[model samples]
Target: MVYTISAPPHKKQRITFSSINRAKILTLLPVSLISIYFFGLPALGILLAGILAAVATEYGIQMIFKQDVTIKDGHAAMIGLMLALLTPPEAPLWLPVVGSFIAISIGKHAFGGIGSYIFNPVLVAWVFIRSAWSDPMTPLSIPHIGQFSDLLLEPGAGLLVGVSPIALLAGLYLIYKRYVEWRVPLLFFLTVFFFNQIIAFVSEIVTLVQEGVLNPLLYLATMFTFLELTEELSFAMVGVVIFGIIFLATDSPTTPVTKQGRLIYGVVCGLLVSIYGLFGNYVDGTLYGIFLANGVASFVEARTIPASFSQESVLERSYNRVMEKIPSALKFEVISDD
Candidate 1:
């Protein structure tokens, strides 16, 4: 009797939505829920406007460029909505629409859309909108679920001002799960905290001279160290860190593949965030920092890969070798010794 072994038939792997991608989408739900719970119908309106604007812009651009419409990806629209929600409640309705248009049309689709954008789309929108409408974008006191007078008394009322502890925890979980890069957020927060501490120390010294003793700076610092570091920081800032970890800095098309390059990219982003916080007029420095880092990241990535990999012959040979290994691995043989 003759024995024969045959390899299994080749089957193309179908691309399906991954659990991580689904989890990312689900993560957005919590923030959205919080916004709706606190800010009510207007928040929802802004979110919807931004989403619609982003989708329409994407579709229109694709049609004009003769590219396949990929609006179903849902990433761009979601980003636009999140950005809108992060903005001040008093922000003109047209600003969200315009910002969403800029985010999708220029920040994202112009660069190749979806994963190709170097900066976070939402961050980009935030920067542009804030710059265009500085007054309304700064902050507003609006009615939240439980507080009426607190809204009137506080500086940035109605609008969600401080970071959400719940959202931050969720973000950290995503980082631990490898859904987002841990380095970007960790580095950014540390850098910001350190810079703010230095600023506070100087301010304290100034107050000591004026009043002959330490003033509010010391108290503020203690509070910051205990609470505000994690809570008082703006959600826009948190969003920037989260966006950098999961979206902007991790973008395969815009970011470097090598570990060293990624490290440099993350550090540059951290530094930019610190600088923007200190020098930039916008309270949310994260967006500006991300935009700057994205430019740097793009440059870094272009120089990362070797020229050898770009050659067609080398790539083809490598592809052939990988394909040839599939059949031999499936065969089973037994050896008998006397």
Candidate 2:
């Protein structure tokens, strides 16, 4: 009699690795189609280049290494589509190809594949391409900006996914499906919103002062009376923040494991985005911010884990060792009742 030995996830559930990828693909399909509608053939060409390059690269690497072919799982294709969405519409075809190649070979595979990777592979590839070729990464200006519909449907500036409200709705579905947790994305948005408002308010105050407006107290009183204290916040990159927090920052393997750690990590990512956005470009800042946060995710997870009282923690052990070195008179022992 032969007994088959299998991996630890022996208990079956509806959500499998492949199923998750399929859900992601479905969620992102609308975004891709809308990108084509707005940007036309160039967008189509870029999307194809990224997807094909990622799939082909993953296939070639697996074949050469004589490993099980996992391309059918759709992880490679998802990475490709995501990279393409973040790309500028006018970017050359070769750009996605190169980015996809890097994403598969180095970003995904080099770090021990899929769940073992420490960084979001798409963001890794994007940084590489942007740093190497800054010129082509600049997005083209939209010809006209008139109706509010344009902002929701197509604002042809910054990254392709920057102003896409569809992306936000799709991201919400991912949350509903239980594929992603609500903590990180929620904290990230809250941090960005509050920080941005504070910055804007301070800037407005400075502007008023520069314009020779007298009686600061009167300005404050008028603000309170009219309820005009809060400035209108621009959510130009809300789509980018939503999509990124959902797909990139919350990547199961790379992000924090504990709920508290995830919340802290999200705030850190948002703060970095806000700071970088002030000093540089918003789209670039979002990518870099997430990348930096990924670097510290493991550390955050380690510290956030609740220490067991039954076992001695590292800090406790160290303190005990230090106490042992001190003179007997200097340390008092607690008397335990029998």
User: Which 10-residue span in candidate 2 carries the lowest summed lDDT?
Assistant: 224-233
Q: Model 1: what TM-score?
A: 0.65
Off by over 4 Å in 2: 1-13, 142-148, 207-232, 311-338
lDDT of each: 0.61, 0.80
TM-score per prediction, in order, is: 0.65, 0.83
TM-score of 2: 0.83
lDDT of 1 by residue, 265-287 (tens): 77677677767766752335555
RMSD to the hidden true structure, all candidates: 13.0, 5.0
Best by TM-score: 2
- What's model 1's overall lDDT? 0.61
Query: Which residue runs does candidate 1 get wrong by more than 4 Å?
Result: 1-21, 141-163, 198-254, 279-282, 300-338
